[model samples]
Target: MNTPAPGPGTLAEQILRGVGGAENVESLTHCATRLRFQLHDGEKVDQAALDALDGVMGTVPQSGDRFQIVIGGAVANVHSKIMNLPSMSGGGTSRPQSDADVKAAVRARGRGRFAWLDNFFEYLSDSFRPLMGVLLGASLIIAIASVLDALGVVDFRAEDKSATWVFVDAMWRSVLYFLPIMVAYNAAKKLKIDPWVGAAVMAAVMTPNFTGMLAKDSGIPGITCTTNATLGTQECVARVFGLPMQLNDYGGQVFVPLLMVAVLALVYKGLQRVFPENVQLVFVPFFSMLIMIPVTAFLIGPLGIWAGNGLGEGMSWLNGNAPIVFAIVIPLLYPFLVPLGLHWPLNALMLQNISTLGYDFIQGPMGAWNFACFGATAGVLLLSIRHREKEMRQTATGALAAGLFGGISEPSLYGIHLRFKRIYPRMLVGCLVGGVIVGVLGGVNTEAFAFTSLLTIPVFSPTGVYVIAITAAFVTSMALVYFSDYRTPEERAQANAERDAAEAAEAAGAVGAAEAAARGEAAVTGDRETVAADDRELVAVGAAGAVAPAAAAAGADAAPTAGSAGEGFALAAPVAGRVIGLGEVEDPVFSSRALGEGVGIEPADGHVVAPADGELVTVADTGHAFGIRTADGIEVLIHVGIDTVQMRGEGFDVRVEAGRKVSAGDLLVEVDLDAVRAAGHPTVTLMTVLNTADVASVEPHAGQDVAAGAPVVTVRR
Candidate 1:
């Protein structure tokens, strides 16, 4: 019986074992082909074992205990499997000690050497990353409302709008107006405090009681208000308990919550230390609220408002005095900034600009970067379809949809552009072109904070110029990526070879199965003897001038008799290499004989020739493997280069098509060993017998180098 293929969960389990179990893994994330792991101790990992796993394409170890396991098209499944592992439950909550150790190690590694910088960015990322889904949802809502406004269905910005339009506006406003609470919750969670308490503190300031102070009939005698000359909006001060407190709208104010939560965590933690364990829950939260709420309203909130306004004013000055530079810099800077989470501060500035200036300019130029990103993904999608690259096609399709419709760039950025380095420079050029166009046309501005998507075109002033600029950016990037390609020439060639080999293998398998059915039918009809005779004759003809006389005689005489006691066959070496026992192969599938008994070969030459006269049964698209079936019922597999499927078929030349008859020693493929090695894969070629269970015994010869036509394995009854 054949060993069943490994299940996805089984593969994940094997990978976890290979990577020193869950304890060694600090955290894991995947992008396309590789599982990126930040490990607690990279030295503890068994690299060789990881590389040998059947589903894993290869292993790469980076600096600082970072490891990557390449899984090809099935990366998403593997990633999901790993995340769902029992040890990975609740986002590392189940294994607190292990998680704590990993985090400490990471901090210790960076301690005292700008480590705070890393922690600061991590804090920012964790705070905003969780809110991305809702943010996109709100942006798309704005896009829809803008679309209706553009068509004159209703005025989206009017204060006295239709009730229906007003309800639609509230749908998106629900997220933005409460954004501070959301940010507070996330920030507090990151700092290991009660998230609800942090949200409660931010919410207290936004309550109706605070806003009631703005009304002229307010009962509080100490309340005073003044109108601002710059914005023409009323600013109010409320005297509470003999102290003056500035009352400002807290909606959509990210800085206040982010700053407030940091202070809250310190107070909360200090209170926890003071209270006994039994009363900690009630007393700690109570003390935290008593301390933080007052501090936030009296100090941090006003300071945060000032900081945001100052930054917004500085950016506005740059935009006015140097419009062209501002426009160009915004688009170009965004590509790098967004990936690092540094862009959140700038995002906060955009909201501030809309509130104070009655319009925002940053998003107009930022559209160029977003469109350029989507365009590059589109180019990859087109290439995937053209080349029959199923995995890439799926990835690019989903990424493009998320970008174009939702104004979300994360999917495309992490899934594609980052994987292939060539895409960035080309995408940047598109950003530049779009920015220049906007600047030359006196720039684009939007009255409302809208996502820069096709649906939100109405939000921008001078819609025509915005449309032209974005179109140019999209077209330019798409054309560049399509023509030049995101992948290097070697990568492209390898991918093409893999596709061809897969098609050939599929075609060959169909033919082989049909032939096998016919032979089985002949045996049922008592024509076994004639069939056996024909098999010998066919083998002799195909192997003529290829095998030694003794080998040919053996094939003719040892042909399986009708209702034979056992099945047996021999495999000739397909390539000139130093032969090693199957047990010595790195890959577990072949080493365990899961695919059948095989011999590993360290190639001395690139040429791969047929080992026996037979019909080609399978051809791998990556130009890395081949399968053949002889008339005597012997099945053979010839694989070139270990983990080479990850290379897609680069540096391999296939000389013959699958399903074709070939004599022993026929040229099958030529591989470039140096190229394989350069691409970070092994050059060990393998030849295995797929039907080992049907055979009585398979004896493989080792301990010496073998020529292409050499009989390295013998199967017998």
Candidate 2:
């Protein structure tokens, strides 16, 4: 018996089951549209079952036992649902790390050539990803202030700004000024340490008592202050416990926390082992703060400051000397960097530049890349509208909105750009154009760290240059992608055919419902069974009565039709061959009856025909598969060969389009069996009833020689 199709309420449960019943899941997290899972056993995942779920858009299997399920805009809700499931109460929220599990996971992660590199990026990403909402919020506040400053409503830079303005400034400044503590907390959590201990250690230096010593007139003994000639910034040193301490402001410094947490995790875990579980929690955090606070203040603080400054200086020199090259490189590299999570370090640099150098040059050029990405999505959206590709249109619409308004490119990149190969090249061209414009115009700079978005335009200096450059990039990519088209000709045709068939099926369903209502029957739309028949009666599988097509259309009460009784309808063989059970089809999804019960045929020849009279519901672009819905609503799928889609239609001649009416034994495609075999694909043709659960029974007569149009399966309503 088939499992019932999942609805919205059961989507999370189905997804959990699909990924090996929560036990296999190590950890689950979500970005904008996908639920990312780190699983213990990737092999245990049932990709077919998840794909069959209604809410799940698609599934992606990645390296190192990772899986991603795309849920589009509803990802957050679905993720919440999964986490809230009763089965997930134990260890589903995160991986349960026993000694053996940890060792095995480490081995799996270390197997790849660039395993360390992957781990490094993942660490950086997790530390900053949770901070995006706050960061974006702060940036927008800065943008509003910048706009007000531009409009001369109030002098934002005035030393004696009003109390209200200062308070407003504090709203955004609080997030940036205390950013180190936040990063430290997140980083510690990522490393599986006590997060509060990390936050406290970093917070120690940011306190008023420590910063007060920086004032030369504070009258603290053994304290000294100096001014840097090059950067024109004050430096302070103080004596604590008879040792010199570097009393620098740790506010907005991200690198310090990142460095501190790495060292802290080791100390934390070692302490955990040394002390028993009863006393460990209190002593661990107590000792971690005691050791890490001084280490951070005396050594890590100054080192991190120096490191941030040195990197900032390098970028400053590049922008000063080779402005054009620097500008061009920022935009072009961002396209690649953003996908790999390598962009986080550059983002840290942006904050560092704003903190140390008073303004950042990286964001000016990076805007070009962002707008170009949005432009490509716009092109795809326009084409989806033109081609009437409903699913693509919806995807592109949401992705484009997220990009243009939120200044987020993940939706555009992951949802559309990555899937289609043709889009990236065009988007790159736009990035190059925008970068060139910024380079030629003396480059752009922003005093505040802001997302490259239209709302934040005023935050950047030389706004005209930034505006012109981004516009050129957007228009260039949009025009190029729109003109060239995102999909190939064959793909477009196939997509349109699928759309038409879906529409026809929907229309047929509506007619069936109306006919049932007219006959005073309680029309149960969900209970109706549809076969590989077009314009035939849509029977209610377990309902009291079934309606015939002719009688239903005429609004008349009719007796059982030819296909309504238990005697059933015969589905003829599409080709002359020796029939076999679905189990022998050599395809797991088919052999397991996941797509429904059917037969496989070792073809004697290449000619393929319609199994029954119906409208062709779907015709694969690669000419490897067909779906037919009979007049009595039996949806049959005829797949020509195993994995033959990889052949790219090289040896198959298709004779029918979707939505075309056909009869039993009608030629659907001409397949070259030898060519299929040479391409390393099986030549055995397989057929299945797609809506098998909707019918009373589907019985396949296999293990026999069959001629074309010979009855090979019997179906009952």
lDDT of 2: 0.74
User: Which is the leading candidate under lDDT?
Assistant: 2
Total backbone collisions, model 1: 10
User: Where does model 2 exceed 4 Å of error?
Assistant: 1-107, 110-112, 151-156, 216-222, 311-717
Kindly list the per-residue Cα lDDT of model 2 for residues 546-599, writing each as its tens digit. 111111212111222344447688999999999988767676555645456678
Q: Which 10-residue window of candidate 2 scores lowest in summed lDDT?
A: 542-551
Instruction: List the candidates' TM-scores in order.
Output: 0.52, 0.53
Residue 696 lDDT in candidate 1: 58
In the range 183-296, model 1's lDDT, one tens digit per residue, is 899999999999999999999888888767777678878988886433344568888888999877777777788889988998998888898999998999898888888998
Q: Candidate 2, residue 359: CA error in Å? A: 12
